[model samples]
Target chain A: MKAFDYARATDLSDAIGASGCLIAGGTNLLDLMKLEVETPSALVDITRIGLNEIVPEGDGLRIGALVTNAACAADPAVRRGWPLLSRAILAGASPQLRNKATTAGNLCQRTRCSYFMDNRSACNKRQPGSGCAAIGGINRNHAILGTSDACIATYPGDMAVALAALGAQVEIEGPGGTRHIPVADFHRLPGEDPSRDNVLEVGEVITAVLLPAPVEARQIYRKVRDRASYAFALVSVAAVLRMQDGAIAQAKLAFGGVAHKPWIDPRVDSLLVGETPSKALFDKAADLLLEGAEGQGGNDFKIPLARRTLAAVLAEATAE
Target chain B: MAQSPAARIAVNGVTYEFDGDVRRSLLDFLRRDLGLTGTKKGCDHGQCGACTVMVNGRRINSCLSLAVMHDGDEVTTIEGLGAADNLSALQKAFVSHDGFQCGYCTPGQICSAAAMMEEIREGWPSFASEDVAGRVHLDDEEIRERMSGNLCRCGAYANILTAIKEVMESGAKP
Candidate 1:
């Protein structure tokens, strides 16, 4: 790791205005630094900035940026109101990692693309203008939905997928002022500039995540991976469903490990509404969600795997 | 050249203040500076839990944390758990169960299990839990899922599981 200046910011303004990379639960950033993948001249510790609470806001909840994943998942309000969020977090990294990884840190974590982590391989996400090695190389874990000519790395996270399905908003504080960005629009696709992951601007810091009022729907988060635990999702599905008169009243779906961001499409929800839950209906919804999903050689299986996983989650969610 | 930062941390009930490089990990500081060799480093990355330690009562990967970030924090390492002459209940179970062969990941496994039992007592749910909001039941599946962070290359997982279950069944505090 490179030598750097470290400062602990005592206030939000001090943290946002500091000219350095923000550090909270240095689980991801420090690992990248050890590999020299992310060499920052300075690190501003934001753990003490007093954004570590999970409080009730109106009918919804506002989760502080510094709340660790384990704490967030174990909170009584979160478990009772947003059970899927808790389940998604628990489905992610092991107990030790979830204890240290924070809410803002999880959203800002980098992709697990081997080529991107390895400095020797050509990766546009790590270094702009460099060719993408995963496009032709071993892409078994690469994305199939949000692929670009520049990159095909998947956004490896589970909590964000649940947030996207729940229509959560990200609160940002910067020099300009505070602004709220919908979770769906927070992450950007790997287009021309794959180096940038989210819509966070320079000197801007994520303050908290604003979850809307809890909905009267059954929520489920199912992940499929090579291992039973301590592994990233090969393809995961987050589903929120409401039934009325033996028919679907509302449906929201978000997919992970299949795109550059949490993949969500309103058309699939529209198709499921007013219809009874059935494999045929879910297959059609899967068709709409997987539209134009072209996979690289090694990851072609994800296309069908995502379809089956989505179907299974929807079926389990609607089961009597 | 710029001067290193000064940080004060309490480890094993003893407070130490020093000036160190900002880039040095807490794991490195413990092993190299404090000479706490009980906490071993398996894979410098967070993927391997051989460097696990408790910070402020929560277990975390010491290798992924900077020592400077731990200012004013209380850390409990393997040495803090118990000495060789007076081994902790969890440590004694490991010895009787033959939970390890190489013993490289023992400290991390013990620290993690110690904190994990606390999590279970607090009704924290795991992936294996059928009900997220309900009381936690420490089944074999739950133990394996919770301890997945620590990797034992000796394939002593069966013994480790037995040791942890024994402690839990004995109603002894780890």
Candidate 2:
């Protein structure tokens, strides 16, 4: 990795106030640095800035972006209150990774651009206007939903997808001040400007993510993929359904491995809200969500695979 | 030599100043800097579980992470799991169950198992669990799901799980 100034911040104020690129665990940052995808002149270390605390905020739990993946999983509130988040984190990489991975860094990690990782090809994500090679090249794992002609990269983290489903709020500190942004709006889709990855502005440091108290619903996070473990999702679903006497009260659905952001399809959720938990409900939601999915190649199967996963999760969720 | 980012990282109760390269992984710093080499590096791409360790008691892929990020953070590596003279119940159980082939992924396996036990103890549910309202149970399927992150090329999951079950059934750490 190329040399970069490493400075430690003292507090949330100092950490967020300090200049240069912000690094928490350096898991994602260093990986990109090694690949030369990120070349920050200086890195402001924010781990010891005392942002690792999981505290009670206004309406929910305020999870410091620095909180380790393991801590989040073991947290009482998270374990019981937000099983979707817990299951999502556990379904992610590994124990060693959860230790070093932080909530904020995981949320903001660069796209896992294979061509960008190669550093020799035209990746609009790595280099703006270089053109996307994956558009014509191997796009097997590329997105099938919310894609543009510019880019088709998918957001890789599992927990973020769950957060989006739970209506979590990401709190960040920028030149303005600390503000709460809905997790659903945090990441952006590949529109005309594929250069900007997330909604985070320049010189902004994510302080915490707030997940509201659990709704009385069944949350089932199902990620379908090629392998059983340690791989990105082929098409993952983070769903929560509130059932009253075997009838759906409300349902929340968000997707990963299909779009730029965790694809939160409330339209699908709306379709399933009044209906009973059945294959019919899942199929309707799948049909509604995939209507927007413009698959180019082999990714066409994800449309039905996503439907199957929804049915499976709804079946499992309604079972108990 | 790069300025070692070693300064008072409170690891597992004791504070140690580990001399580590900025580019060196948290796995390397734990194994080499502190002379606690129990954490092994399998693939270094965060694919393998050989470098598994607990940061504030959460399991993570250490190879993918840098050491500098762990400043003042608590780390519990495999060496802290009972030491050479002593052994954690899990460690003893692993020996009893013979959960090793080449013994390369054992350290990570134990660390991940310990962390997984803690997670299970905390009532965190996995994907395999059907019921979430009741006490989240860690059955064969749940164990397979929790321990799936730690892959043993030797495919000693059966024995590895037996060792974990032995420790769990013993009613230890209540």
Best by TM-score: 1
| Model 2, total clashes | 10
Q: In candidate 1 chain B, what residue range of length 10 has the lowest lDDT sum?
A: B1-10
Q: Write the per-residue lDDT of candidate 2 for residues A1-320, one digit (tens) a residue.
A: 77777666766665655667877767777778877878888777776777788888765798988898867876777767888898888788765566678899889876775876778989887788899998878877888888888898888889999999999999988878878899999999988777787998877889889999778777878988887866789889888878787787878888888888899877887887777776766777778888878776867788778778878877777765
lDDT of 2 at A250: 78
Which residue pairs come into collision in candidate 2? A70-B58, A95-B59, A95-B60, A96-B60, A96-B61, A97-B60, A97-B61, A98-B60, A99-B59, A99-B60
Which regions of candidate 1 are displaced past 4 Å? Answer: B1-5
Tens-digit per-residue lDDT, A1-320, candidate 1 = 88888887878887876788888998999999999999999888888788899999999999999999999999999999899899999999989999999999999999999999999999999999989999889999989997899999999999999999988999999999999999989999999999999999998999999988989899999999999998999999999899899899989999999999999999998999999988898899889889889989999999999999999998987887
Candidate 1 lDDT by residue in tens digits, B71-113: 8999999999999999999999999999999999999999999
TM-score of each: 0.98, 0.87
lDDT, residue A199, model 2? 95
**What TM-score quantifies how close candidate 1 is to the native fold?**
0.98
Go through the candidates in order and give each one's C-alpha lDDT. Answer: 0.92, 0.79
| DockQ of prediction 2 | 0.35
Candidate 2 wrongly placed segments (more than 4 Å): A243-248, A275-282, A314-320, B1-6, B9-16, B30-37, B54-59, B73-96, B121-123, B131-134, B171-174
DockQ of each: 0.60, 0.35
